[model samples]
Target: MKMTDPTTSAATPDEELSALVMQISSLSKLALDMTKVCIDVKDKLPHVIAAQAAKIAMAIPETGETVSTPWFEFLDAPTPEEMAARYPSTNGDGQNYHVVCAGRRPGLYADPDDATAQVTGVPNYVREKRKGRFEALRFYKAVYREGRAFTAIDVIVSDDDDE
Candidate 1:
């Protein structure tokens, strides 16, 4: 059968078939590239998780404190009020504050447990302090070993221009 080219309005079945094949080949290559990108991300997933876990571990206190409740199972196991009291003000600026986890600023509160309304509202509280700007007190957990037991290291975030 005779075939006509749609774009050029010319009868060239061989050329049309060749063009279609090339287009298909290009699409296949693109799909392969995308698959590779996905695979790369998947391959790095474990490392990312491990890094996050390490950070959390570092945030705990070195005293080897443990909590009975699952809610307070964090490293330091500080209550919301305790955290607020511990860091009453950032750099003693006379502004009361709350603690939030690291990630985006103003960051999300690190309250895994349904502690209190103040803990839940930490993000909003910080945002209000910054006049609607997002900010957070990032905490990190680390582990150091002397012999057998690993000592927990509490890493507090300091004010930096990079943040």
Candidate 2:
């Protein structure tokens, strides 16, 4: 953000745009630094940022002016330990099942519906050893599921019933 003001600079239109981009990049870095220092805000950062982006989009009065909002695609996939910490496994009917997503009907469970209950070709032993690498990530929908630990994609939930 330590750049000369674009208005002050007698630069071309392209140069002015470049300066704006730089300022935006600096703001993003500063936001990221804040997240690193603030542990409590990390979980809520994505939602807050998205809201701001949406606000910016709405503020633009120009017709067909598309405002690109940030996506969780940049974030790294959650580690096994992170998965366990975020969504711990729940024991039910003498079987282990982790409530990965919240929905009317029970979403994909940790153990798949198979004789061996292996998911994504990963054995249960390795999954357990890793603390839930395959077991948690095997469900593709879980990544975008409500209350997921790691952000992957945004999902619009129309169902209001919480079972």
Candidate 3:
């Protein structure tokens, strides 16, 4: 059984089989290495993608200007006094005059007739006074009753620090 260079000399059956086995073994190892590399890449892909996205977000656009939506302005919370002034009561009876419901329940609607109506959920507000300044934290639901108005009824105010 002669084992010579495959390109130059003819090899015996046993030699050919041995060469084929060696090639298969080498190819198997290469395939395993490639699989490991792919696995490692897959594991790190999310972080790499996130970093790239962050970079893209921070980067200036080709037009050198950034665009924003106007609706985002509504998300800003107005001061308590400002909120009251903005949503004045319609009727002469100023019972719940600029009341705004600040409850956590979503899709909760406010009633215009009853000031203390519990339709959606209990209204909740947190009032804190520091250094003679009072700050009230609550959510306001704007309703279109007797014109546009804000109501804070049915909301509960938690004054834990009130002595």
Number of the top candidate by TM-score? 1
RMSD to true structure for each model, in Å = 15.8, 18.4, 20.6
In candidate 1, stretches whose alpha carbon ends up further than 4 angstroms from where it belongs are: 1-8, 60-163
Q: Please give, for residues 2-114, the per-residue lDDT of candidate 1 as tens digits.
A: 77667777738998999999999999999999999999988767656664565455344347676322221123233334434654454445332333332122122334232
lDDT of 2 by residue, 1-163 (tens): 5778776866799999999999999999999988887976776678556645543443343587553532222222344445456554554433444433322222335454431232222111122211343454445234332223222233344458454
Q: Each model's TM-score, in the order given?
A: 0.33, 0.20, 0.32
Considering every candidate listed, which one attains the maximal lDDT?
Answer: 2
Whose TM-score is higher: candidate 2's or candidate 3's?
Answer: 3
CA lDDT, candidate 3, residue 81:
56
Q: Give per-residue CA lDDT, model 3, range 82-156, as digits (tens).
A: 654654444433222323332221222234334333223321222212121111113332221111122232323
In model 1, the worst 10-residue window by lDDT is: 140-149
Candidate 2 local distance difference test against the native = 0.43
